[model samples]
Target chain A: MSRVLSIVTGANRGFGSSICQEFVKFSPNKEQHLDFILFARSADSLKNTKESIKTLSKVANVIEEYGVEMSDIPQVEKTFKDCLDKIEWNKYSKICLVNNHGTLYNLDKIDTFTDFQHIQKNNDINITSFVTISSLFLRKVKALPNFKDLEVTMVNITSLAAIKPFESWGLYCSSKAFREMFSNVIAEENKSSPNFKVLNYSPGPLDTDMQKEVRETCSSEETRQFYLELKKNNNLVAPGDSARALAKLVFTYEFTTGQHIDYYDIKEK
Target chain B: MSRVLSIVTGANRGFGSSICQEFVKFSPNKEQHLDFILFARSADSLKNTKESIKTLSKVANVIEEYGVEMSDIPQVEKTFKDCLDKIEWNKYSKICLVNNHGTLYNLDKIDTFTDFQHIQKNNDINITSFVTISSLFLRKVKALPNFKDLEVTMVNITSLAAIKPFESWGLYCSSKAFREMFSNVIAEENKSSPNFKVLNYSPGPLDTDMQKEVRETCSSEETRQFYLELKKNNNLVAPGDSARALAKLVFTYEFTTGQHIDYYDIKEK
Candidate 1:
């Protein structure tokens, strides 16, 4: 049977966990099996996620999990290299990388920020780490012999902040915008490579811990009010629903390269 | 007579020096005198720029220059605060800040990059410092008791990279995109105040040292070809001409707030 390699970051909880769960539920087939590599800050969370995936997939796929601190640049780089080393590239007919890990500092006014470290940490986790991880993954994928014969998809999990700027989200919003454009440029650069695709995926507001933190701890009145209203109106999408939709979009071959796909965009597709 | 504070970063040479020289040449009027604050890393280069400005305008404006490394976050913040402390806010009828300082690391393919620090430095000089400097400036400006009565303009010098990504320019391109979005957000947030304006100014390709570096050092065949073609065709705009045009756009009252103005955009307006 042909194998497929799939990697997701922040795989311990929320959208990341749900994404892995849905992928396992939907991707099992008689002709193909998955080799999963998951990343999170805690090994235990990743193990839990792996167990959940195993429960969904039965005995269909192999699973591996790693604890990686996104802010520790060297560790993140080493973990990526280690994962690539262990993957049996020739056995896999397809590979996918989903960048779902990101961090948001306390929602505070940009002007009132007391420490520059917070800004650095925000960019490091949200944007810099994304660049580093993607670069490493792309390098390895491009080096594969007979690479064009295998399918490859790299999905950058973006948010509405990528296009719209929120009041207290100056760093977070700007970093997401950086990723959006970076994804576009990468797509353009690799246009001749038919097997490779890049998608700027905006999953929309989900009932994730990230959103819950915003509703509870956001100091900006305007931002707090907006999230609170979303909850009151039951407007937030469940993580599982969004993940199922996202997994389907990831597997579909009809989407254009370097396209920005949101929940609605994928739904229409 | 009313005073106008004009601050320009990366003012040692290139477009920055030209911008200062052009500002002095154009802004001599009976109603106002400019107090120029020029920033760059080299004290000697800033002194040269100040001397050039003096030669351009006989005795029309007060000139000051400071050697500032944009990569140094603490120094950047301290210098901004010190400048604000010394400024007689009530004396100036208008104030303008031109963020012209940006660094492009030696052009290299993103995948082959061996040093992560280079990427960190690129984003720091291009986007993070811009945010820090602008936040400090805005906080001080808004604190003025009669902030609405005083005219303020924050001009961020962007490039074609802000919208279009160039080959071998991944870090440079993404950083400018971050600044572009950040500028847009700030404009939206300050919409209630009419006296404040933010311009994400795209200066276009100019006959400057940075372009010279691109023509000489760029390793990517596609990028070198594009820039070399511009030079051969004499399509690169002269720094003085672009600076003069940009200064005119900055002084205009008809421009909308939070607008992304390019050389062509302003020419049409």
Candidate 2:
């Protein structure tokens, strides 16, 4: 039996942590062992997620955690490459990378947030790093022995902002849009490679830290009220539930790449 | 008897310079005086553009050139604000800003360009500064006496990349997309006030230094060949011709805001 490797970002909290939980508790079968490499900002925070994964896991698994600062691209690339080097690539029949780390740094109107420093910082952390990591992962997997035999999946967590223009969320919206378009381009680039899959997944409005930021910081009354209502009406999807739905969609054998899918899309199917 | 103030970026050469020429020589009537504030990297280069504008302009026009580093937001904002402050707001019947400055810095594959520093720099100069300049222009115009009577227009020069995905041009494509979406949001925000109009204009493939860069740097053979063919077949539109078409669309009385329009879209009208 072949092993499975799952790498995830923002694994210290919210949807990211829940994603780690979902994957760990997913299957109890003894045939395929699992390995988890989680990326987060704090070593202590990752320890908590590592502990939770161990408790829920039934099959024997290896859980590794790293403190990842998205702004430091050099360090990020090195850490990811090192992780790949340490692991035995031939053992895993399935390899997946979930790019879940993102930031809505400021709720100011795009023009009001005029400082290039702030804009550059946000772009680096949210969009550019995501691109770098995705590139590195793809390069690593393609170098593996019998790479075509193993399934390789790349998941980019997208947002409604990717398609919809929110009044005050310009930076967030456009960056997510970039990720979606980049994913589309990547999918097109890899059309000839059947084993490789790219998915831009919009895990709709989860009760995450990002939502809290939106609720608190949004400049427009309409946007503020919309998020407030989601919370007031208990309409926001829980992180765990979203994670389960996302994992279900990801693990589905018939799931196609090059698609921007939402939680409801998977749920309806 | 009202004058016209035209502020343009990347005006040292190429499409930007042509846009300046089109506006200066637009009307044969001597009643409307023109004031041109052109931005570029070097003072000497801007002087050359100014000299050309002086030679081409038939009307009695005042041309001022400013060397601006687009990467520096504070300097860009200050220079723009100073220029606006020096002008008599009521003097010009039309106040227009043309955001034509853009850089396609390092057109390497997104993943292969692993350095976040380079990516961040490109994003800052291309997109963030454009937003800053637009915001400042809008603010300055709104503060003008009898602002509603003066025709205020903000034009963002976009590319085919704004709507289409091209390989190895991730940074350029996404930045243009951001500008397009930003233009949309700005138009929506100003809908209640009709005097303020924002346009995202795709000028098409002009024979500019940018196309030259594309021809030289495109990593994908298909993209490289396409641009090469454009140059070889003399299919690329001249900057002056593109500028005339763009100015025609811009100056058209029936043009609507909130539309992502191109040369063909205007020409067919």
Candidate 3:
């Protein structure tokens, strides 16, 4: 039989693909088992990713669902609904959902490239879709009888960008900050649900294309200098390193489900 | 000249009407300097309100912009922008904008209501439009070279319902909470503005029709009980009293902006 499925969005490259690799390492084979229902907007990206990770585990059922952006609520809702229909809730004791996909919105030059549409898109994809999808997920799990005993862990992979907003990243920062509060409310809502854990994490800076893109896009001389300074101080962590650390937290961290787990918080705990 | 052209949305009843009355108390002059525009969606409601508020000393600009709903962003954006355009910002020292009109999303059973569009609508009006309009106001004042010296005050008439969300009030409560944070961010942005003060206030339960309507809806047992407790304890302040308290804050409490001002906070300060 197929191993219990784990779904990861934006798994073409960067943080998302790293998360999938780590999930493979910690597939919860002790009680039951786990596989991956990989999700990304680009099938070509997913295809390349599938090839790279193919040798990792032949038994690992990498069910790929590409071309779904988290911001597009209708597509996400339908895709996940189909995935739910296909999956066996009884086989999996827990559905560890990693919301790692995010669209970066940087208004470098207010006059040049500052289209507020980017902000709206960021709000839709990064924040609103996460919430809408989560609501759908809750409805799905609530429908299952055996899964009634299991808690659903929702790990929102947020960034330092949420709080420490830069000048150009106005929209992206605001949406992420708002999303943090939204998730906090969600956690509060699930207080009665013992099996529900919603974790908002600030994974330390990773050497990714997103980071480089942001660096290139930022217009403020002071802010650009600050980024350089931060980088020179060796502040950025590798995605793979961060992934392993996150994997450890997911597997070993025996805390309640609905806490905002930042890197400092996790280390402190 | 009109006593600082003041615009209040949803002014037909509840907190909006009360806001109109209270604004007059702290005008530049009792006779001539007062322009209070009352806006609502319904023609009947607007006319009835116009008749009630019409007086010699204080001129009420009864605008038939139709009833503005917080949930509909496009309608709100257009209506609010149109209403804003007619007013000359130079005539008024302080354009006191009190967004007191709001509607709670509730139902006997949620499925009867359809989708989260209503919830989306509530946020659009109460949160998104509130912020958007405030931004427009800031831009308006900033555009004029002379108005730069004058003070502008924004008081968002919020409810205790937002602080502690109840069943059936998911959208209303969360939207208010979200708006507060959004307000804070905006406040931080406008800190450098020579004359700007923003405050989010929970006008202790007013004896408005909305309160009675809330009581009548009676969907969630918990919210019903809470309302009863407030009414029993005389915690519910009359709209006039609430409005007076808010007006005083707008004029005299310009020092205290960017904070979530509660009824108790006013008393304490």
Candidate 4:
């Protein structure tokens, strides 16, 4: 029987966890074994995700859970290297890497950003590590013994802020833009590989802890009010709903490689 | 008599030096005193720029030249803070900050990038320092007692790669995108300030050392050839020409506060 491997970062909770569960719940092939390699700040945090995935699909198994500090470049490199090295490459016909771990450095206007340490840390976590991990993943996977035959997909969890600037989301917006463009270059570089796919998926204004933080702490009163209105109107999309759409995109492979697919755009379809 | 203070980074050579020279060459009010603060890796390297500025405009003076390592976050913050503190804030009725320092980290496919240190350095130089300096500039200037009466302009030296993704230019494209988005947020954040102006200027392809590096070292054969053709045909823009257009925009201030005005866009006009 064929097998699939899904490596997900930030899989401990929120949208990341939802993505893992949805992928298994909606799997088209019950006969195929689905293995997961989950990464978060703590391996222990991935317990709920592992339990939920097992409950949803008997074919699914949580193969590995890594405790990783994404901001520490050296550690990130070491952890990913060990994980990829241990993977039984020949056992899986499909592989997907979801680069989803991120943070809101602060909800403040650009002029007011004074803490240089905070800024550097934000870049280290969001841009440096993301690039480092993505580079490692592509290099390792492409060198596999049966590389051409395996279907590969890379997803970047992006945002509307990636393309549009927001008043108080200076750091967040720039980092997202960086990731989206990086994903674009990946798509362009791998265009010749028929079995390779790249996607930038914007999960929308999710009703997650991040959203709550945005509503409470945004420096711009107007922006904060906007999020508050979204919350009050019950308009923020559920993590599961957005995750299901993302899962559908991953399985169907309907998107043009490097295309950015937002939850609303897919929902309208 | 009104005075203008211009702070320009990467002013030691290339397009940066051209901007300093052009600003003096095209000053509308020749009688008005012009003061410049130039930054580059070595203050000694700024001799040519300082000399040329003096030759172009009798009233123009190189007030200060700072040697800065753009990749060092703490140093970047300290240098800017010290520079801003020494400025006679009340003396200048017009201030313009030209953020022009940048680097091409590499010319290879993203998958082949293995040096995590190189990636971190690129982000430090391109994104982190840019934000740090810009924030410092804005905060310092805005706090002036006469800020409302002063004309404040912020120019981000952006590029075509900022909006378009190129194969084998992953790091460069992503950093530019980050800067452009950050500039957009600056525009949005300060829209209510009538005297404030921000511009993201894409100077087009320039005949410079950077372009030479591109032609010789680009990993993509097609990209290298395209740049080579531009050089052979003398199609590459002269730094002086593009700098003149940028100066025109600064002086005219006809553009919307947050507009991205490319050289080609203005050349047609």
* DockQ of every candidate structure: 0.59, 0.46, 0.21, 0.87
lDDT per residue for candidate 1 within A1-269, as digits (tens), equals 77878899998999998888887776737446777888999877776787787777654454678888887777878888898888889988889999999987657765566666567667778877888898888888999996989899999999888888778877778888899888887887788898999988888899889998999888788889999999889999888888888778767666889888888666533
Order by DockQ, highest first: 4, 1, 2, 3
Fraction of native contacts in model 2?
A: 0.29
- Restricting to chain A, the TM-score for each candidate equals 0.95, 0.95, 0.87, 0.98
How would you encode candidate 3's per-residue C-alpha lDDT over A47-140 as one tens digit per residue? Answer: 7557655666665557655578765666676777787788767777667777788887664522233233344455567655665656666667
Question: What's the true lDDT of residue A185 in model 2?
Answer: 67
lDDT of 2 at B43: 61
Error of 1 at A94 (Å): 0.9
Q: Against the true structure, whose TM-score is highest?
A: 4
TM-score of each: 0.96, 0.92, 0.84, 0.98
Best by DockQ: 4
Tens digit of per-residue lDDT, candidate 2, span B1-269: 88778888998899988898887666545456878888898667876678777787555354567787888777877887787777777778877899999998677665566666666667778876787788777767776778889887889999888777777777777778778777777776667667778888888888988889889888878889989998999989888877887776656635788677787666533
Count of clashing residue pairs in every prediction: 0, 0, 15, 0
3 versus 4: better lDDT goes to: 4
State the lDDT at A185 in candidate 1.
74
Q: Write the per-residue lDDT of candidate 3 for residues B1-269, one digit (tens) a residue.
A: 42466777788877777777667654545665666766676646776556555652345554334566555556666766687778766676666777766666553322123354444444455555565566566666666767666767777777665556345554565556555655555565566674777788987767667767777886767767888787778877777777777877876755566677777566533
